[model samples]
Target: MRQNPARRNALLDAAIEVLADEGSRGLTLRAVDQRAGVPTGTTSNYFSNRADLLEQLMRRVRERLTPDPAALAETLRATPSRDLVKTLMHQLVDRTRRERSSHLALLELRLEATRRPELDPTLTRFFTSDLDANVAFHLEAGLPGDRGSVLLLYLGMLGLIVDDLTVPEVLRPHGVDALVDSLVDRVFPPADHHGEEVVGQG
Candidate 1:
């Protein structure tokens, strides 16, 4: 039988809803099937087991959280790094909103990864890749060696996102800009930031 693309995505989407609305403990192939309106076996068909489902969901969430590399690089090449950070921060917030379900899925993944050492490698790899890449992006913004600091702030923002503590409007309007500036100041320092090569290949 040919797999249905729409149905497959529906199952995953339903799975996302299950994670977001019901938490990880509530995520099951049956639950996803119920939410997606597909047969119970449909979700299982796409995923082999519970771990497979969560892993796939985590992948989807990371994909959702990630920025467009080609575009970001091009923009970075043309724009000042200082300005880029705020834009990137704002964009992340928007992406989070767009993939709210995935966001919750990621949280569940994190919790699971924390509890299970085996999953830690995958989970850490996913989030660290984002942090490492963004830290590289920050360096492109002319902030040198600020990866650790940026990771912290980035994580802080993520926490706000997870807890629904932030209002995107305020974040972009003033909060994001201020955050960018403050992070740059503390992490880069004026003296350290003049003409340094952005970390990584940026």
Candidate 2:
């Protein structure tokens, strides 16, 4: 049977909502059907089992979370040097905030990756572009081999936001800037306060 694109996406959207509200354990066929306003049988027709549904649901998330290479390159090139890395960091954090349901889905998969190492490789590969983009910025700041640090900062931002959401004014005045700088030091060990760079081919 020919599936309607609109209906298919609606199902994926509903799945994200479900996963966010209740986590992976609560995402059931009946719940998805109710959220999509489609029949349970229709969902089964598309995804025959829980594993199949979970895989496709994550595939949808990958489509949403995976950074677009062109956009990444454009941002890296166009942004001004002064505070540019910090600005890009904020932008990435903001995107995750905007599609928070997607972030929750990513977190759920990340937890699963702990037990299933095979899954972790593929999952981490999906997020590599974002990590590499930040690494390039760190390299420009004179912090070579800083990919691990940038990834740590990215994760830190996630944790910060989670706390901020759960608790009001947790970071105090000027705290965020201090935290961002601290992140840079911890991750990009050789980061110079002021540095110059050539427009990198990479």
Best model per TM-score = 1
The number of the candidate with the highest lDDT is 1
* Model 1: lowest-lDDT 10 consecutive positions: 183-192
lDDT of 2 at 9: 72
lDDT at residue 123 of model 1 (Cα atoms): 79
lDDT scores in order: 0.69, 0.67
Judge candidate 2 against the unseen true structure and give its global Cα lDDT, from 0 to 1: 0.67
lDDT of 1 by residue, 116-173 (tens): 8888887778777777877776776674345676776676666557645324554555
What TM-score would you give candidate 1 relative to the actual structure?
0.72
After aligning candidate 2 to the native by TM-score, how far in Å is the CA of 122 from where it should be?
Answer: 6.2
